[model samples]
Target: MSENDTPTTVSESSETKDRPVLKLNCFLPYQLSHLAETVSRSFSKIYAEKYGIGIPEWRVIATLGEYEVVTARDVSSSTSMHKTKVSRAVAALEKRGFVARDKNPDDMREQTLRLTETGIAVYEDIIPKALAYSEGLQAALTPGQQELLNEIFNRLHQAARERDIE
Candidate 1:
């Protein structure tokens, strides 16, 4: 084609016409992420407002409360949170007197974390409220639906793990 003669190719309008439009509302990953965020934010309000702890801090507290003594690496692995996030949360909790750390007898570099008395009290106070919130959410579904949901979630979890292996 000569420089003077402009060439006509597939226009932007025609190219866009062939592309599939994504509906985020119906997209599985997007829907799952949105639902998880919504639930976490809603539940977090209970701890955030009452205890002044954010989600990461709450996760650390809950983990320590359950395990009694675990390292920061354990918390990160269990909660799937980054090591930096767990460390920061641990620092905040320690500052608030909610967590205590002790050097491991066998490993000087590793420290085990545990909940302080105050942390235990906060955990005790939040447990009932967390159960109530969970029950409230489950109440929206029938018993059969709840059972089916459990099964569906288990299957999805397994599928994700299997996919990871592949």
Candidate 2:
């Protein structure tokens, strides 16, 4: 793909004009999204089947694993998941006794979620596997390429954020 001519347009016909042609393989956004989903699914297998949790649950667990405590809204924002998905995942986790909800005294309607002892154990078990999977992916790139890729990813991420605000 030409970096300068992404989604390169075809001719504007004298007859019926066709829309611009975007090759999915060459489209940056599509490529990134596809890779991310593919990687997530692949990684989910490590935790999903053994732990009986899916993507949304895994995300919530990981967040709670990191922050120790957070609201459903916080999980939604952090994981870029919709609030409904977060709600459902939280419900599932709560039912499984992997998560506990502590009622907010100030706002009875709101609750903060924390991992149960079971959840922490799962998180701890998953960490080494997660790190190994990450290391395997990084092993595909040389040190220089990995560094460059990190910089490129950060730039694109920042650009997307700016565009989102606009």
Candidate 3:
């Protein structure tokens, strides 16, 4: 038989073509997600180990530090966390002496959360370190790339919000 007429080689007992192929790694997105999770977890771990606060607790403290006083619902909205989660975190922070909850004088049923002096000191001590770590993370990317990433993430956030994922 001529070269073009020769029988094609195939997998033994199978009809599939015996050719090299490219296969996408479906775990690529998962791998990226895992990395992101690890980075955040590591940040939390460092903050907790050095400052004695959990991740959610740190967020609560940070927000309360900046706002001085805000409702638990507001913290939930700002953090994109659930109301129950914020409530629980606030309770934990209050138990730790890092947060103070006071019934709003104007509305007896409404309570505002604020960081205690100790919480402010802890937040102040960690903010610079957290920012430095953030800056280090972006050191490999150009300013343009960082901006583009932020835009893409914003769009994703909007889509999630529209879909009621929040």
Candidate 4:
């Protein structure tokens, strides 16, 4: 194909436009959630690349690490993931020898999840790396700025939960 016959990409058009064909600015309060999603995607990709586990699996393992044993519903609630997603993650982790499921004594129908010894070792290895990543992320921010940002995020999250669809 001739050079002039090739189609131009949207980003190239964006740069050459007189008034920015696309406004590209985020005006809604939920826009920050998009940024958070981007950050989570990047972190998950990096962590998965390093450790060979996906984000949902990581979330399940991490949550189980914090609490010795938790129900599938509890995992879903804590991660804000759907029940099916949590179930799939639990299944994957179980296959990888990281998690074990047992009958919940209190509720015979529900299952409780726990990390295996290998899973605990994996969590111990990843926690420091995760902390270092977070520290590196906040390295450029002043302590006050960090605190303010945390407060803002918490307030926004609370508001979103209050407005959530039933």
Task: Specify the highest-lDDT model's number.
Answer: 2
Residue-pair clashes per prediction, in order, are: 0, 0, 0, 0
Provide the RMSD of all predictions against the true structure, rounded to 1 decimal. 9.3, 4.6, 9.9, 6.2
Tens digit per residue, CA lDDT, model 1, 63-103: 99889999999999999899999999999999999999999
Q: Better model by TM-score, 1 or 4?
A: 1
Residue 3 of model 3 has an lDDT of 22
Compared with the true structure, the alpha-carbon lDDT of candidate 1 equals 0.90
lDDT of 3 by residue, 19-99 (tens): 544322334455456667777887886588876677778889878877898999889988877898888888888887889
Evaluate all candidate structures by whole-model CA lDDT and list the values in order. 0.90, 0.91, 0.79, 0.84
**What TM value does model 3 have?**
0.75
**Shift in Å, residue 136, candidate 4:** 1.0
lDDT of 1 at 74: 97
How far residue 26's Cα lies from its native spot in candidate 3, in Å, is: 4.7
Model 3 RMSD in angstroms: 9.9
Q: Would you estimate the TM-scores of all the predictions?
A: 0.85, 0.86, 0.75, 0.80
Higher-TM-score candidate of 1 and 2: 2
Candidate 4, superposed: residue stretches over 4 Å from native: 1-25
Candidate with more favorable, higher lDDT: 1 or 2: 2
Q: Tell me the spans in candidate 2 whose CA falls farther than 4 Å from its real position.
A: 1-17
Q: Per-residue lDDT for 40 in model 4?
A: 81
